[model samples]
Target: MAGPYWFARNIRAGYVGRDRYGKGVMPIAWQGRAVIAGFVAAMIGGGATMFLLFFYAHQMALGVVIYVILVIGGAGTFIWAVATRSDPDKSLAVYLAERQRARSTGR
Candidate 1:
């Protein structure tokens, strides 16, 4: 739902197509791919945590352990993603250039 909206918004915002020079200079595909991948990964992670919590309903201590592990793992991933995130605009520019070159060369 949100993904479609964003894809459309990016396309409308001149982030997915070419300009007067007939050159493709948008990193729309990269952005969309990243967004979808992140969304799916998050959903899976959350679902696994929920399943674990419910599966060990009788064992409260075990449930607590599962929740703790989930929290720690989620926190670690979040921190790593933030710590390693590249400059968005610069990365977009580079992606767009590479895409354009690939298109021109028919690759």
Candidate 2:
């Protein structure tokens, strides 16, 4: 899951998370609302794609269309979320600070 991978990488690099993640798990912050629908669409599209690859290979065109739509929708939602956020640059700043701190501590 590239979404989760990039998210975890950003978190580890201190690019996000103003609040701490409970239970040692942190989900992508799509403004806290679209996460559910996003999850469902991603899971269903991916699962259907895999299932089609095995049983009904001929139906792969349909699966590809559905999967593409899901990806586009997810990307659109992420863009929208960024547009609505007031302090998107804060995370970038935090990331830079973390990098500087790490460099200083290393030397």
- Per-candidate TM equals 0.39, 0.41
Candidate 1 lDDT over residue span 4-53, tens digit each: 21222112233443331222222244454564456457656766766776
Q: Model 1: runs farther than 4 Å from truth?
A: 1-57, 88-94
Residue 47 lDDT in model 1?
61
Error of 2 at 83 (Å): 2.3
Best by TM-score: 2
Q: Give the TM-score of candidate 1.
A: 0.39
Residue runs of model 2 more than 4 Å from their true location after superposition? 1-30, 33-44, 86-107
Q: Name the lDDT of candidate 2.
A: 0.50
Which residue pairs in model 2 clash with each other? none
Q: Which prediction has the highest lDDT against the true structure?
A: 2
Write one digit per residue (lDDT tens) for candidate 2, span 1-107.
Answer: 11322122122353336543222222234433454467567768776785676477767767667777777777676555444442333333354566578788994
What is the overall TM-score of model 2 with all chains considered together? 0.41
Q: What lDDT score goes with residue 46 in model 1?
A: 63
lDDT, model 2, position 33: 40
Error of 1 at 45 (Å): 5.4
